[model samples]
Target: MKVFVLGTGGWGIALAMLLHHNGHAVTSWTFFQEECDLLHRERANEKLLPGVRIPEGITVTTDMSGAAEADLVVMAVPSFAVASTAEQLSRIVPAGTVIVNVGKGLDSQHGYCRFSETIDRAMGGRNPVVALTGPTHAEEVARGVPTAIVAASASRAAAELTQAAFMNDTFFRVYTSSDLVGCELGGAFKNIIALGAGISDGLGLGDNSKAAFMTRGLTEIARLGVTLGAKQETFAGLSGVGDLIVTCCSMHSRNRRAGILIGQGKTAQEAMQEVGATVEGYYATEAGYRLAQQQGVSMPITEAMYEVLYNGLSAKEAIRMLLGRPRRGEHEEVWFH
Candidate 1:
């Protein structure tokens, strides 16, 4: 199988390497001329997946038309850039080609999962889109660590095909799911929970406090997600619980690191600049807060995070505001079936 990864960022480079390592012919396309030149001439992607050597036979190109003939195309760009990237690719990729996305989040202005229905709308004339998501991180993946992810498509056959093509014996695992909404919602909402957990960590709270925060944060996430047509069971899976635990606790989590700085009395701008990466949580937290308000769900963590991030409430004040909320039954069982 010939695969082309649309972005040459960390995830895209990692996936390209994984696909090639699985004995598939792989090529990575980069929009940046320097990255393409570096891969072609220096056999490196120093600007993106730096220090990783590209194996032989993997091509890198800046020509969109050059990669259009691939058997499968994977998108690993950030959510904020997905729409324009999708639009550009839609113009070049042939109809019926397998389109897959790994970005997670809802659009703030529109409030739908990234690539929710908009992907199909943007595809000039393409087949159904597929979503790939899980707890996997790019750095771990670059080192060939074992990881499992779900591939969701309206067409089960498409999902299965992606599973066959992407999954490997030891390093990479892919499962099939018809529940696209669940997969999409799980991928996005877990980041918000990670933000809350990071704040706890910054406040010098121990694992006990962080664990409790994670559980309650998830309750709010599930509430908002279920009200908007996601499955409750999906909350127990990799994109949900598994991803939350890893992101909320790990130093590798840029989102959590950013939040910790905020909690330690740094301004949001200072924290973000210090983190120096795409901390998806800061943006996702706002979208989640808006979504919670729209759904009329009481997301205290989400509200506190929004206040700290957007409304100019100091992080300490936000924490105090949350503690001041009237306590209620901790186990209300908000099942929406």
Candidate 2:
């Protein structure tokens, strides 16, 4: 298969390498000529994926026309760029081209719609969009670490096709799902929780506090996911708690890293600048908060994160607000019963 990975970030470069290794003719696209030149000249992006080499077989370019010939287009750009990239692809790729969205996060510009939906809408619903997401971090995956990820779509054939394109016996494994909503929501919401977990870590709050935050954070994630037409069981799958665990725990997670800095007394802006990468959780926090409000779902962790990230609520005070909430049972359903 001819694959065009439309982004030159760590995740994009890593997947481009993986596809090249899978025997696909791969081309990676970047918006900036400097990035394309760097990748073409050096065959490596040291700042993003240190020590991971981009194979010479993969072509890196700034042109979008190459995507027109691609059998599969991997949308690996950041969430903020998904709409424009999809729009660009709409004019280039033929109708029915299979697009696999590896970028995670809701589209804040479009009422926090899922990336799959955002891409589909941008393309005038001409393409079959599949969301490929899970706990796989770019840092680990770039080094050929073993991990399982899911390819989710409303169309089973599209999902399975994506499964076949990316799955390999050694290192990368792929599973398919019809629960696209669940998968996308899980992928996006986990980052928000990771921020809170990072805050806990920054404050030197022990394992107990972090664990509590994770558990409750998942509950909030599930609550909003289910409210928005996602399956409850899907939240237990790889894209859900699995992604949450990895993002909240791993140092490679920019969201958690930024949260740590914020917890350590730096402003959110300051932390983002220091991290020097797109801290997705900062955007996701706002989107998640607004989504919860519009849906009337109870997501206390998301709310606290929103307050801390956007409204000047200190991290410690956010923790206090969460801990001081009215007493409630672990499960709202059980409490009512």
Candidate 3:
């Protein structure tokens, strides 16, 4: 299979490497001419994944038309860049082209899943939109570590098609699902919990706090996800629990780093600047807050995260606020009650 990946970020380069290693011919496109030049000239993305050279078999281009014509086009662009990138590719996406979304976050400006409804709108509602997400980090994935992900689409056939396109023996595994919305919600909401976990780390809170926050934060995820019509079990799968575990515990999670900074007394804005990369959690917590209210869901952890990210509440204050609130049975709303 011939695969084309859009964007020049770490994720984009990583996917290109992974797919090429899987015996597929891959062409990676970037809007930035400089990055393409770097790939061709140095075989490396010096800015994003320094010291890890891009493999020789992978081709890099700045031409959007060339990428859009492949057997499939993977959108590895950032959340904010997905819509515009999709629109740019819209002029060229072949009918029935499988558009896979690897970006995770809520579209803050328009309040939609990253490339979810937007890609559908961009393609005139013709192409299949698949989401490839899980707890796998790009850096580790690029290094050929064992990683499994859920590929979700409205069409099970499409999901399976993408799964086949991505599977390889060395370190990558793919699972297929037809629950597009649930898979997407699982991917989106886990970042917020990662942020809270980072805060706990920064505050010098013990493992108890981190464990409790992540566990409870997932409840908030399922409650809101169910209210929005997502499958309840989706939140317990790779895109949800799996992603949450790696992100909250790993140093590679920039979202968690951002949260830790905020917990250590830095403002949200400062933490973002210091992280110096796209930390998806800051925007997502805000989106989750609004989505919860709109869906009539009770999400205390999400609300507190919103207060910290948007309302300028300190991490200590947020912790105190949560502790001060009334308590309830753990399985009150969850199943198995």
Q: How much is the lDDT of residue 330 in candidate 3?
A: 81
Clashes found in each candidate (C-alpha, N, C closer than 3 A): 0, 0, 1
Worst 10 residues of 1 by lDDT: 109-118
Q: Any residue pairs clashing in model 1, and if so which? A: none
TM-scores, all candidates, are 0.93, 0.98, 0.96
RMSD of each: 2.7, 1.3, 1.9
lDDT of 2 by residue, 3-115 (tens): 99999999999999889988999999999999889988899999998888899999988889998899999999988899988888899999988999999999988888999
lDDT (0 to 1) per candidate: 0.81, 0.91, 0.87
**Candidate structures ordered by lDDT, highest first:** 2, 3, 1
Local accuracy of candidate 1 as per-residue lDDT tens digits, 158-214: 799899988999889898888788788778878877876777788897888788788
Q: Worst ten-residue run, lDDT, model 2? A: 328-337
Candidates sorted by TM-score, best first: 2, 3, 1
Model 1, residue 295: distance off in Å is: 2.0
Error of 3 at 113 (Å): 3.9
Residue pairs with clashing backbones, model 3: 135-243
